[model samples]
Target: MIRARHAGVAAGAAVLLLLTACGSHGDNTQSPAPASSTDLTHLQKLVEDAESAASSAESDMARE
Candidate 1:
């Protein structure tokens, strides 16, 4: 399980790396900054919602 999880993560990272290395030939003058606190906060909210959904699903399954 651990190996599978690691492999999955590695595969995702490889994809991201490939995309980054093969940059677009267009102008990047309007690109957003790499890191932003607002983005982090939004991601945190998304994670919370996902966890809540998972918990709700588990409870639903338990009652079935």
Candidate 2:
């Protein structure tokens, strides 16, 4: 059950990363900055969110 929740969060992060990458390609406003740096920020935030989710999942599991 824990693994399943983690997997879902991982998958969501992957999809978000892909979407962010795709959206950035067409924007020239931030073209000066490389995608790697921009994506890194997004990735970091996603990681933080994932951790929070895992914590929440753990709490929920405990209740169950």
Candidate 3:
């Protein structure tokens, strides 16, 4: 009975140690910079151009 209790405690301790080692704390080290106003403007232009081209292609296909 005593040996069984020791084995249980050892197993529990091993599990706790493994869990603590695998946990992640918040990572501020590699966080992305917030997009600047210039970046947003460039992205908006790119998206608009892509959508316009897609619409033109779809319109051309519909005419065919």
| Per-candidate local distance difference test | 0.54, 0.73, 0.53
CA RMSD of all predictions: 8.6, 5.5, 24.3
**CA error at residue 63 for candidate 3, angstroms:** 0.3
For candidate 3, the 10 contiguous residues with the lowest summed lDDT are 16-25
lDDT of 2 by residue, 3-56 (tens): 587768977887877766655444556553345776779787887888788888
Order of models, best TM-score first: 3, 2, 1
| Clashes in predicted model 2 | 0
Per-prediction TM-score = 0.48, 0.49, 0.51
How many steric overlaps are in each model, in order?
A: 0, 0, 0
**Model 2: pairs clashing at backbone N, Cα or C within 3 Å:** none
lDDT (tens digit, per residue) of candidate 1 on 1-64: 4344444555555555445445454676455335355655655565565555556666666787
Task: Give the lDDT of residue 33 in candidate 3.
Answer: 44
User: Compared to the true structure, candidate 3 yields what TM-score?
Assistant: 0.51
Which candidate wins on lDDT? 2
* Worst window of 10 by summed lDDT in candidate 2: 25-34
lDDT per residue for candidate 3 within 6-33, as digits (tens), equals 4455555555444444444468535444
Q: How many backbone overlaps does candidate 3 show?
A: 0
